[model samples]
Target: MAGHTSKRTVGALPDTTAESPFVPVALTWLAWVLFAASVAALAVRVLFGGDWAIPGVVAVDGLTVLMWVVVTFFSGIVHSYSRRYVAGTAHETRFFVLVFGFTVTVMGLVAADHLALFGLLWLSMGLLMAKLIGLARGWRQARAAARVARRHFAASSGLLAVALAALWWETGATTVSGIAAAADTPGGSVWLVAAGALVLAAMIQSALIPFHTWLLSSMTAPTPASALMHAGFVNAGGILLTRFAPVVTVDSALMLAVVAVGGASAIGGKLLKSVRTDIKAKLGCSTVGQMGFMIMQVGLGFFGAAITHLILHGFYKAYQFLSSGERVEHTAPDGGTGATIGRVASVGGVVVTLLTGLAGGALFAVLTGKGLRVDSGLLLTFFVAFTTLHAARDAVQQTSLPAAARYAAVPVAFLPAIVVYAVVYEGVSALLTVEPVSTELTVLHVVIAAVFVGIYVGIETGVHENSRRLYVALLNAGQPSSDTVMTATEEYNEY
Candidate 1:
């Protein structure tokens, strides 16, 4: 049984192997070539394309061109990778066909300016992703997962349609840019309803908290498809919010609500991740946390920072999903001094981390000019400092290094990371060229920020482990639907 069991790595779990079926990956190669060409053309356009539009149809501005390149580059990598991942599978041809069509559909999606075209492409994206999820035609669990996803996607598209239609009718604008331009018009209830609907749609698409079940249930998909989904598809929410920042910021109350929702998802996703056992599920939770952060960035009126987060996250997550097979380890720990650090040694580590974080935050403020006031920039700077401190804490806790060396590693590792992040952040902000719709930091924002801090402290103190109900709730919250799991080998390996 052990010898004959299918390898757990890659996409081998989805389908039964065939006896040399001469898999035709020409279509995948074609998709890659087209995606590559699209990347090059879009890059050149970004250089010379000074904000032109085809009159309520397609736009060729910084946002469109940058998004096109990102979508195509990630699609190209996924397509090229899939040629090997789906080899000799029963539905290989169907898989490639869907992927090729999906790539073009997403490219059109980002470039679309008219409401109808944008909504159509959005619906198509959902359907195509559903098809990819259920690629294992003979597998019941895969089909069930696909159905669940399709339903969630349809609801999301429905909300988007309502939002777009309301915006068009109330503002009397045909294109997205036109609607955005007229966002400040006093349309009363219509504007609020439309904006609220838009937020809900993005939340569903990004898999934030309560709407996160679809993403968690989608693990039945093959690895390549999972990569594309995580690296590009789910990030549409951030892009959506970025493009429609004006509408969201029109009402201060609405904007604060967005911040609150995003904070909940970010904090909740982090807690959920600690209880998940599967590698892909853990990654899914991480995506939830990441999308939460992106949305929160948007709510804080840093659309440029949100875009940078999505792009960098795309690259980081693609590599993670693609190389997830290499993550397997034996029951026992390996490759270290096999010694744990003592508690008294940790006291010095805390001081080093604090110093490094302060230095990095100061450098970021100097480079970006964002931390002087009590606005979103100040909060963003705090987050940067907090994240840098945590990363430094991990590095300094490595027991393999001597105590002094471990403490010294904080400055050595963090300085470059902070510098590179600041540079890229400034570059992305410059590329976008659009300023925040709002930057006022209210009392509510401060309270929400404090709530975020409290959650992190509770998490670090192992409070969750002390409470059985909290741990179980988190475990259950992160699980897929009951039908999505393949319990018996025969269920998945039937040939």
Candidate 2:
């Protein structure tokens, strides 16, 4: 574990392509806009049923758009910070191009309603993310990350293929809707088994818990990639579950299994988050936890919660990963007043919100006997408590240490907005039976707040000493310029 520091400096953002200008920034933004439009269309479809109303596929598209928007924002921040951090570099062009390519494939994946279309897009995204990792960091370990990604992609492909084969055997068709809709009338068992197997594939991609090593290895990528993969790409698995809700809801045992995996990952993520020292690693674990929450929502038949969590977690995590310590400014010891009533109110508001969720979930669980006690709601409670305490403690310690220019106001200012938003969102969700309130949704809203608190704590405790060390590590993670693929491919052609 790395030591926590109050004063840290992020490396300057790299602009590797200023001279070459290979990929135009305008084109990048254009791609982002199209992606955003696609996402908005999907969200509208989710809100109101559409022509091609495959809810799961629609949800994926919507979430992809939202995640891409998040990445766009992060890219802007990274660009701004890099002016001072990275200065000048030749690889930035390649970096952005690969990033754009990666996101484009992800968009295609979201829009894919057919099984074959999905497989193509999914594999493409994996390839592009791996390529971007190597381009951005040039790390010796980038090759390792790429290897893990390939294994994951292959496993996913195999699972999907098995599902398809089973479908063909059962009903002589591989279409997602066709397999299930016709399953009961004729030979359905193959379709059921195939669907079950595909669910496992989704789990692998989601990085729930046991299959989380690929995600950990991916942390070696640049911050933009980390934010995109963790917050955006990883959510695809949950989106897949939501996409196949028709099949999932019918099988009680399968739904329960999904719930089980989601619960375990949520709990596991919160626990792992406590002990992690690497900044991005902590965020990655949180990504796992958030995915758990999304999966639980899908498993429990709460589509709204799944989308809402995806949108909220995606933006914040991306921002936190990219911006990090960039916003901090060292201040005099007596620059600001000590903790105020507002901070207290903010913390108190968070606690109250969490308690409200737990009470709601507990009541629902007792009355309906539907969900597990260890699902997303319970994990969210733990997240809130853990993050709030850590953030407040870090804030206090940083101020007292007189290390960096204390920008206490930055975090402190957000308190009122969070409290107000939580109150309104929860109150309204309760009032409207249309979007039935659940322990899971309540849990998500609070956890989003907790994410903010976690970032504050990470910045305060990490930016001082650890952040600089992190920068050094990140810079060193890049591979040497001369170590291109051609050189390695030729040298190891035998293997």
The TM-scores of all predictions, comma-separated, are 0.91, 0.62
User: Mind giving the per-residue lDDT tens digits that candidate 1 earns over 3-39?
Assistant: 4677576543433233423333556566667767767
Q: Please, what are the lDDT tens digits per residue for candidate 2 over residues 1-495?
A: 246566657554455446435354544555656656655654664577334446534323333444445445544444443333323455656666676666566656655656677677767776777675555443555665677767776787688677667766766654555544664554456656876877887878888777776776675466666766766777777666655555555555566567667766775665556445456666777777778777766665565456556657777876777765565445445676332112322444345434443444444434333344554444433443343444444344343433222334324533443354345335323322223223333444445545545644444344423445644543333222222223343232110
Q: Pick the candidate with the highest TM-score.
A: 1
The prediction achieving the highest lDDT against the true structure is 1
Residue 141 alpha-carbon offset, candidate 2, angstroms: 1.7
Global CA lDDT computed for model 2: 0.56
